[model samples]
Target: MLNIADVLHRWCRAARPFALATVVDVTGSTPLPIGTSVAVDEDGNAVGSISGGCVEGAVYELCRQVLRDGGAPQRAWFGYSDDDAFAVGLTCGGELDVLVQRIDPIRHPHLTFAFAEVADGRPVGVAQVVDGPEDVVGAMLSIVDDRVHGNAGSGPSSRAVADQAHALLRSGRTARVAIGGQADDCPQSLTVLVHVHAARPRLLIFGAVDFAASLSQVGHFLGYRVTVCDARPVFATAVPYADEVVVDWPHRYLEHTEVDDRTAMCVLTHDAKFDIPLLRLALDLPVGYVGAMGSRRTHQERLRLLTEAGLTQDRLMRLRSPIGLDLGARTPEETAVSITAEIIAHTNLGTGLPLSSTSGPIHRPAVREGAVMK
Candidate 1:
């Protein structure tokens, strides 16, 4: 959804008729995770991709047919076909279940607002009816806080659906739920898909050096809301590499900024003058990662100074000094990769070992929950 927000915003506003096909469920390995979508216009132009590029041609045709025939909600499964001649299947050996629905803005008043919400990076969710009475098949509910827009059904059924959708929105996870009387009450229910449009995690880089630029670019590509903070106005002025370039003391900037469990802070200034105070506050915060770039001697010095400033061993332990995985990176770009790799590995709890050296599964197990059929 994040990847296709721009395109959705465009088509939804053009008032052009289109059909959206979403990956509601997946089995085994998949190139794109669930909740990913592709919208096909009346002319067969596509906005996003659900299966990387493997079966897009076939999916495009299916979407075109739906638009032409004005069909009911269609469920299409693409899998590994034993016969090589089969038209649409994952050659990579996985299975995907897609639910395609047509949304007419002329009929559904909230249709434009839903796409605009995602396009503007707002906190919003959509509860789409995939199965039930044919009339409710394409029904949508907008999730904002505890309230919902649009209709799911009449009386108790609508309230039940809205409550379940709000639960999923708060959790910021996608799920398929069947709602009838009360939330999660019975099998005599309507199947709905809830999608949460959460913002990407933040990566705050506290430097404006060559390495910082490279790291900023890599962080941006890694789907981070990257910001570069430096005390020197001259250094901060030219940082087109980050989402935001702030001219302020690293500690001051961090003190005023809001950080959450998903935020990662990197101290690349290397100088103790800037590093000491910043690390003092960063290590004590609830951020997911706090790493500093310096030599072994510098790291030891930093630890001694931080300890003298009343930082406990527990707080110091949170710091990832001499940052990045042991990739022997020398160039700025390579160092950026190494740093981002370490960040990813830390977040995923990965060992950071080469696949050839490790026997564990290359991809982590999907903690998928929701959108289950009874």
Candidate 2:
């Protein structure tokens, strides 16, 4: 888990040239996501992992050649196929498509800036090489301060791809795109990897109750930047949250904080006075998940209040009141599990039905067998 700053610092100090490999796209039970990257030094040192050790060895060899010869970038596809299997295929019966590139770090000052912004908790993006020269293969496009920095080569086509990459950055998606080509062109032939570096999930707990504490802990475990915001100064102190506590009015905090599709706001306040305004703010934003804790009657009351406040049925439908899924959870810990499970299910668009009832794919197809490319 090398921080972006540390990655940049190490890259800056390296005197020799090296190639970087990134998992710009994965399919069918693959090990990594679109932005997963690994930096390979000339000596065969690897910083990050793209496929949980599945494809690193093969990618390292590709990187070594890129370092030796500044060649055009190439896309490498690996999958577990009993018939047409490549040497780099996943052993766990998954598929991964990796883009590998040799980058001239000296020429790309903006790459440093992009990683720095990520390290400092600012929103930036990396343009992963989806289609490009082997030397600059799978290398990400570095976007900082609303401008594209690394294009491998600057052209109108490159700029057009960069614009799309920037848009993807705003949406917090990491994937490849085909652009600026005729309709007859192959869909997968287009070259661009748009990888956005977004802020980690933010968990804003409105209440300082014990349930809120357990939820915050769970949120932290799930890689969220947990912030326990409460009006109670004593309860919202650094003891519970340590480095991530916020002592403020929940409504005011929601007003000032940036809530995007990557954000998850939980209204555990369970009090109409404190919860209403905050919930209203969340409903107005494009936040991914909004959860409110209460019983069935409590939710009905809150709905009445929200309707009185002119909240529409469409917006009200977005609220997951009574919080988590129905696991008959009674204790706070069980309730926390239920709530987090609901959040994960919502995030992944999971059906909540037993897997035993399902007959098809286990994981998302986008992660396996090049389905996303189609």
Candidate 3:
């Protein structure tokens, strides 16, 4: 999803009337996932996307209606049917439930903080009373306590909603959740959409070679904070693909940096001075993926060197030497894709086979935390 901060803040600052639309829920396959949002202003200016193409036009009209009528918050369902009369529905045979509301920035002060949370790369949960009384229809707030943006509702309902929102945020997902429980009987069901925006993962490419250059671009496109580090100051002066270019020893740069389970380490530096020391440090770290680029003989020699340096077989196994899948890649760009594909597969726990050859769902749920840093 595009940054909501830019669109909403601009409109708010301009004092122009606008409507905010969000995909609250989705079932089966969908063009856009739930929690995707778009801001439609009074003059029909739109930013961000909900359903790429399928239900966008219909959603646009809903936004316009809210703008024309002045603050009419409503939930809409766009789906497919065999015997259909409506001209507007998803042709992909999926269902989408969207929540559209006229949000006055001047009136709803909390929305600014929610947009800021997304901009700052801090995770925030948005809990809205989707199905509720008229007074609380468009009531929504960011699930952050220290911030001025607080809960939307009052009483038992608000407490239950906060707990549910926190549980969903910890998993780092966006979905529709039901709150409110019973004491003696079947309690009321309040629907809240929990949208969590975690910071993008980091990808460190330790080389200024052709493959590293190409991989840097691909990593940025895949939503990673890309950094290209090399020992040669001239070679590492500037890499257009990477977000940052650092001229330092690969191992030294890594040691000074903060790497977590979401960090991806790509060691493209074939020289032993850079590769051996960096790979030794990388293999033991808790990173999402550790890769090194080299020929068969080069990799074997590197393995021997690593073993002499006190790396065990189990620790050495974590290194994907001669990195990337066997795609018969000839060019540096193609090799970059091969390596990127392998990293994505490792992160998602996929077999890296064609969807047609797979039996189960093509898009498996986010089963674990980015594939356990393995």
Clash totals, every prediction: 3, 16, 0
Query: Which candidate should be chosen as best, given lDDT against the real structure?
Result: 1
TM-score of each: 0.82, 0.81, 0.79
lDDT for position 113 in model 2 = 67
lDDT of 2: 0.70
> How well is each residue in 144-232 modelled by candidate 1, as lDDT tens digits?
65567887766566666778878877665677776663445433368887877766678999988889989988988877889999998
Local error of candidate 1 at 53, Å? 2.6
The CA-based lDDT of model 1 is what?
0.79
Q: Order the candidate numbers by lDDT, best to worst.
A: 1, 3, 2
RMSD each, Å = 4.8, 5.1, 4.1
lDDT of 2 by residue, 1-374 (tens): 12334575467556445677667666667756666777777777667777778778888888787778767665688888666555667876777776666767686666666766777777776655456444434444567778767664446555666677788776766667766454332222346766666667677777877787778777788767877788889877663442377788899988888666657777887898888888877787777788899889999999999888889988888898989989998887788788888877777777777889986556663321101110
* Candidate 3 lDDT, 154-255, residue by residue in tens: 666666767767776665566677666574331455777766666677899999987887898898998888999999987887787688999999999888
> Could you tell which candidate, 1 or 3, scores higher by TM-score?
1
Candidate 1 lDDT trough over 10 residues, lowest sum: 365-374
What are the lDDT figures for the candidates, one per model? 0.79, 0.70, 0.77
Candidate of highest TM-score: 1
lDDT score of residue 277 within candidate 3: 92
Angstrom error of the Cα, residue 362, model 2: value is 3.1
